[model samples]
Target: DQQVKQNSPSLSVQEGRISILNCDYTNSMFDYFLWYKKYPAEGPTFLISISSIKDKNEDGRFTVFLNKSAKHLSLHIVPSQPGDSAVYFCAALRGANSKLTFGKGITLSVRP
Candidate 1:
């Protein structure tokens, strides 16, 4: 079974609108959660992250919320822009090794 899951295969949003992506995890030991945006030919770039100790974390237009009790997390983008279109991956890290476990990723298209 996959430890991390992104149920949505894709998401489409108009420019200046809001986009929401969801992620769920089965591992309770996961303490660090992160969101990464990847383009067609490049590697994923870090977006936002939240630690299990915090309920929410935000940076500019991106925000990440973590619910430890529910083993769920969500990423929200406000005023989505065309450049924001990419594949978003949810990742989790735990313990000293800090190995990352990533979700399947969701393709996001922001229309102008």
Candidate 2:
């Protein structure tokens, strides 16, 4: 059905702690994965991505791990900050088109 699912709508974390966000996909044809961070009203920005050939990818404070066998993935943010508080969307690409199928969105709140 090409559905990307983010079961949790929101998450909260304290400053300097680790924040974990999870996602799942039902489409076996998907080969690429991405995570985007968004602020209010604006489009999501590419954060990190993992290809089906790899199990994990990292970018500075953000890391994404993919488990193709289970069709699951997660994003991790370490030393979370107040500025990190924003909505995160999990997306997937089926082919070379580079277009993305998004989850409903998850709001991350980092308390100071």
Candidate 2: tens digits of C-alpha lDDT, residues 47-111:
99998899999999999999988999999999899999999999999786766799988999999
Local distance difference test scores for all models: 0.95, 0.93
Q: Which prediction has the highest lDDT against the true structure? A: 1
The most accurate candidate by TM-score is: 1
Q: List the residue pairs that clash in candidate 1.
A: none
Report the lDDT of model 2 for residue 45.
94
Worst 10 residues of 2 by lDDT: 91-100
Instruction: Predict model 2's lDDT versus the native.
Output: 0.93
Model 1 bad stretches (over 4 Å)? none
